[model samples]
Target: MKNLPLGMNTLAKLIKQNCVYVDKTQMAWQLICQPGAFFLSRPRRFGKSLFVDTLKEIFEGNKPLFKGLYIHDKWDWTQSYPVIKIDFSDGTLQTRESLDRRIYEILFDNATRLNVTLSKGRDIPGTFGELIRFSAEKYGTRAVVLVDEYDKPILDNIENRDTAKIMREGVKNLYSVLKGQDAYLQFIFMTGVTKFSKVSLFSGVNQLTDITIDAQFGTLCGYTHHDLQTHFSKHLDGIEQEEIKQWYNGYYWLGETTVYNPYDILLFINKRAQFRNYWFETGNPSFLIKLFQKNRYFLPDLESPVVTEEILDSFDIEKINPLTLLFQSGYLTVAHTFTRRRRMMFLLKVPNLEVRIALNDHFINGYTDLVNEKIGIQDNLYTCLENGDIDGMLKVIQRLFKSIPWRNFTNNDLADFEGYYASVIYAFFCSLDAEVIPEDIDNHGQVDMTVKLGDQIYVMEIKVVDGTNADKLNCNPALKQIQDKGYADKYRGIDGVTVHEVGLVFSKASRNLIVF
Candidate 1:
């Protein structure tokens, strides 16, 4: 059995070290056949660097490394080209001046590799251009350029718009050099997490093609189901496949097949247990949290569809923009896209279950309202559900309404209470591994919450009372509303699943609940 390639990205090194390699040979072959200035955008740690390194070995005329591989006999070993690879992940540049120095250092390093000497006193961009031209001239071949994490600097300062803009400008100055040197470049490939159209490098050099949504290259960056089944079959066979699928296989791109984040999948298998979110642990998402806060967007809405183009693009970091930042950062992808009555629209949701839970925890910590507080209410709703005390549940709801922050709940602002209550209930039951669903009977309008506890099923109806009449509560029209909605109609045929219905009402005056 081959070991997992945890952080290895070099194809030759992985082969020599006897690490597991899921062959993306077909994709590689397709790329080589139609090579040009290409840009691919994918989430972080999805093997972009490995793909770039593979391209380097192939184009640098390393035929020996291709032995027993897909392109072994098809590729020509006699043709070798100079390669200039840039990895913008060293955290070397913090300011514009430092950025300029780093760019010069990168150029010097590449020039030395090609045995080309640079004279003193040359501008950074000018020296970089000279190095490419010199390498091509000396080697009698065009140089292949590969850039990884091309947007790292901008992402690092996303929280500070001013700093992010400055970094963008400095990086743009370095990338603009590529535009005029196309004649001396054989092929140029750049990979980054987000697509920033305002970057002068992309705008000035209109020759490069973005293959992010192209179906042919959709699986180019991440691992596909086929890759997992073929390469990691044994490791998966040892674990619960259903649990793995539920956690990692929800992301869909271009309406094509779902893919697993290669980094997360490998880490999960190596660790031999379902652990806390490893992907989120790689970097801080404080910028994203700030975006959510500024936008006044409900964090729970992340599980549902968040649709808007302005939120998806041209987001000003100075303000909170959940849709734009999430999409740009790769946490949410284009689930579906179309023009609705002349405007382009997209459906945005959490990419996978791992991300969903990580995001939930992130919001839970950031928002004080999400946590439970001991105040004017005496009963605990979570404890009632755990102990199967249905009456206790009703009393708890009554106390909750009494403690309602009227200022926060007025002016129809509490419209999201249904969703909020549902989320809290769901979280509570999920903590106990109980199957729970909110608004499960949408057609009947009968049930507010449904929980499968042991062998019994509980059906609940919740209503907000506007008047103060404990005796007239059952006589109220809301009592009949649940029966009219037929919330329990679907459970008629399931044997051994006893269903119990409970109605609980709340008062808007005293903000207290009455249960029968």
Candidate 2:
């Protein structure tokens, strides 16, 4: 196996140094066939820059890299076009002036590559235009423009709307220069993480074809399963294929297309060990946590589909929206898309188990309930499971519920609060290595939670009621709902299994847990 391209983004260097290449050659071939301007949005470090650099090499007519690749026989390598590669990932741009200075510098650097020096102290837009004209005049061919991480400046300050808007305006001004200069440009391709509305970045450049959701180029930025199996066969010879898939291979782009995280996969193969959160550790997303807190999101729903384009696309950041943040940050991806009554929608969920565990820890920290808890609670729960103590488990759960901060619970309605509490308890037991099944009791018609402990199973049904109405829940009619629904029916046949039906109610006025 070749050395991993951990921090390397330049395609020429990667090819020259003989690092492991996942062969996106077919994608390159298809991209070249498409006409006009293009834009692609993918998560960070998913080979976006590398794809841009590959285009830079291809347009510059670097024939050597294509000798054994897919475009070897098809592309006409004789025509070389001047390529302007603008990468905005150098440093975080906080101010408008700083961004302008950085843009000027990048344009000047590209000018020097073409052997054309700016006279002196020229404005960024003017310098950029001059570079295009210079390339066309000198090379006698139109220029190929590739802009990478085009939204980095705005993304750096996404939490601060004002700052992000300022940076967005600056980028819009700079990009607007390319609109009318079609004569000097042969093709333009820009890559970023998020697809802001055209009014946000492109402004009037609506000619930019967004290929982010295009099926043809969906596999352009990441390694497909076939690419990994065929190209990196040596690296997979001794490793557990299932483990690798669990950790890095869950992102779905086009329908039925499964892709791997090139960054984590490469790093793991090079280091030869199963490490946790390799890509996430590259940068801490503190802002996402703040979003979660502001929105008061229920964390346990990470496993279920949180589908809504409006929430996913334009969710307000002032309030912490965990689902949107997770989707935008690549921890979760678009599982599938469907059209209903002329409306298109996407279904989002946790990509895989790796993300599931990582997100669980993230939520645990977001809420204060996980920390400063009695160690005895976990110990008692584990012991109950070991001894098949159904009654002991229920007691442990009731005790745990009583420890919650009452003031916070009173704000939400009783029934909703009960559901939230039950979900959290389900997650807690799950984290402790206990087998807890959710929505499994058919007897009560609505079973909140169920736990399987060796030969013993505890079937639980939870309900929340106000302090004044709490007595109504203890009546036999309410308890009979659990039996009629057959919530405990499925577990009856298991050997040595004990099923305990439990009903929990909470007071909306006082935020107190009432166990029956």
Candidate 3:
């Protein structure tokens, strides 16, 4: 078996080093078959850079690297095109000045590599246009431009709206030159994590086809199950294939099949087949956590988020939708699709176990501020469910709610809403890797939350009372509703399953459980 290509992105280098390579040349050939600009959006570390490098090699006429590849015979190796590559996957760029400097530096490095002297005293756009025209002219063929991580500058400053917008405009200025250089460019491909709206970032280059979700190219960047079983079967011998699939395989793009993140699979095999959040831990999602709290987003909504096509693409620095952010960042994947009122809609879900656990853990931290206490809380909660101790479970939950800093409630009236409280509990249970079902359906009605652990099941109903009614504990509204709706009836007759119905009522004034 060939060695794993961990942290290796260059196709020539990977091939030379005898690394296991999932042949993507057929998809690459499809992309460059026509002379047009294209764009691909994938999460970071999804092998976009390596794919870009593969395209670079093909365009550079490196035929020796094409041995035994899918496009080996189909592509005309005699024809080589001038390739201009730009990668923005490096360190963060904070200010507009820094962004401009980085663009200049990238342009200079490209010019130096191609031995094309740039026009003196020209700005970023001018220099970029000059480079494309000169390179194409010198090589006697139009240039093929490839950009990797095209939106990193903007994403780096995503937490700061003003700076993010500034970075957006700066990159837009550099990309705007592409439309004018059409005559000098044979093909163009840009890859990034987020797909900024055409009007915002790619207004000048509206001709670029966004194949992010196009079915024809869905498996263009990630590894298919076939790729795994055919290539890495030896390395993963004796491992439970079903377990691996549950942990790291479920990313989809409306294709015939789903894909696994190459980074996750590679690391999982390299680390002795241990299942860890290898991909999720590489980058911090502090901004995303803050967005969730600031928006008071119901955590359960992510269980199966149904959004219109417009919502999926409605992303901008000024108006950042958390769902869009999550979807584009690989935290969510489309599970189903349908049409209503002539509008396309998508039903999305967390892709796999790794994302579900890690993402909820982050949200739990944001909601409860129980960084150090979370492990103890999860342990106690797990033990309570294992022992069927309802009172113990209630105390553990109450402790979590009390741990939230007062500032989390001061900015908004979130405490008055049942969703706020339900969301917190949902995050906690989900982070425990339990079978947590929010808005779980039954014959009679929908339950607020249901958690199944081993042979025990917990059905919970949450309610929030007004401040004036806090002192009056005369009503058991939450528990009464659960009983009246027969929310636990669905699982009561299961052979080995034990059902426990619990009601939690919170006060608007105190924001803690008043009745449990």
Candidate 4:
């Protein structure tokens, strides 16, 4: 078998080096066959760079590299076009000055590659406009412009609105030049993780078509199930098909099929098919965690977040909805959609077990403690539940709640609600990568939560004591409620499974936990 294409984004090199290729050239063919500017937004590390490089190779008329590819026979290999490519992933752009420098460097590199003279100007917008017209004039054909990570500068300074705004304006000026150079351009393709509204950056380039949610190109960058089974059968010798799908497959973009992150799959296959947090570990989740920490967005809402097109498209330097950032960043994906009041709305969710596990781990840290995630919380909870030490588990949960600074409860409007407590606990259980069902149902009515381990089931009922219930703080009403409601009945018939009943309570007056 050929070596896996882990971290290999150069299409020509990947193909020539005998790396496993999944034949996205067919999709590539479709993209270029159309006439118009196109934009694609995919999560970081989802092969956007590879796709951009593939386009570069194809337009450069590198026929030898395309011998067996779908576009080899279909494309006019004899017609070589001038390609001006700009990649924004190369440097730090924390300020307008830095952004100016980065844009100039990228433009200079492109101009040199195309052998075109650029008009000497201090302004990037003018230099870029001149480069396009000059390149087309010299090549006797329109130029193709490919921009990879076009939003990096803005994303890099997202937490700092003032810095990000300055950078956005600078970058906006550079892209605005593209619309004026339309006469000199053959095709324009821009890719990024965030799909900021056209008004923010691309209002001048009005012809740019956002294919981010287009069904036809949904599988363009990620690996599909068919791709895995057909091209990676050798690697699937011992790995369970269902397990693989559950771990990484389920990123949807408004189509029937779901695609898996290529980064996760390549690493999984290379590491002897061992399941792990491959993609999540490649980047830090701290920025995302901080977003939730500040907003106090309920963790459970991540499972079924509902938003309109406006919400998904609203990403500016000064304002950002947590859902938009999470969806655009690959931490969440389209679960499904509905037409409500004649308007399309999408329900977003964590894509798979990998995202759920990784996100909830941070959820525990950012939501509960904020001070320490290194407390070995995951391991301690795992140990407690595995040994059926309910008391230990309760104590650990109490500690998790106590780890929060006093200010969190007093300062945050949303943190004191019982829903907040339930959401954090749900996040804790889900972070274990276990089967945790929130708001589970039983014959009697509803259970607060249910979890299944190796051969054990846990049924829990939780409550909060308002000051009116201060006299009942020491009472085990939670246990009485669970027994009275028969919340454990759902697991009664399991032949070998043992059911553990847990009743948990938090007292507002005492600011503590009680367990029975």
Report the number of the highest-TM-score candidate: 3
Cα lDDT tens digits for candidate 1, 214-265: 6787777777777778889888776776777767765555636778788888
- The candidate, 1 or 2, that scores higher on TM-score is 2
Task: Report the Cα lDDT for residue 418, model 4.
Answer: 68
Lowest-sum lDDT 10-residue window in model 1: 370-379
Model 3: per-residue Cα lDDT over 1-516, one tens digit each: 899999999998899999999999998999888898999989989999999999999999999999999999999889999889998988989999999999999998998989899987999999999999999988999998999999999999998899899999999999999999999999999999999988899898848898988889989988999988999989989999999999999999987999999999999999999999999999789999999888889999888988987777658888889999999999998898889889888999999999999998898888778889999999999899888999999998888888888987776888888998999898888888888889989888898999988899999999888763645777678898899999998888899888999989998888899887
* Per-candidate clash tally: 4, 11, 0, 0
lDDT of each: 0.69, 0.72, 0.90, 0.83
Q: What are the RMSD figures for all models against the true structure? A: 5.4, 4.3, 1.6, 3.1
Please provide TM-scores, in order, for all candidate models, with all chains considered together. 0.78, 0.83, 0.97, 0.89
Q: Which portions of model 1 miss their true places by more than 4 Å?
A: 199-201, 273-276, 306-320, 328-330, 334-346, 369-516
Looking at candidate 1, what is the lDDT of residue 368? Answer: 25
Q: For model 4, which pairs clash?
A: none
Q: Candidate 1 — which pairs collide? A: 311-324, 398-513, 402-511, 444-485
lDDT rank, highest first? 3, 4, 2, 1
TM-score-best of 1 and 3: 3
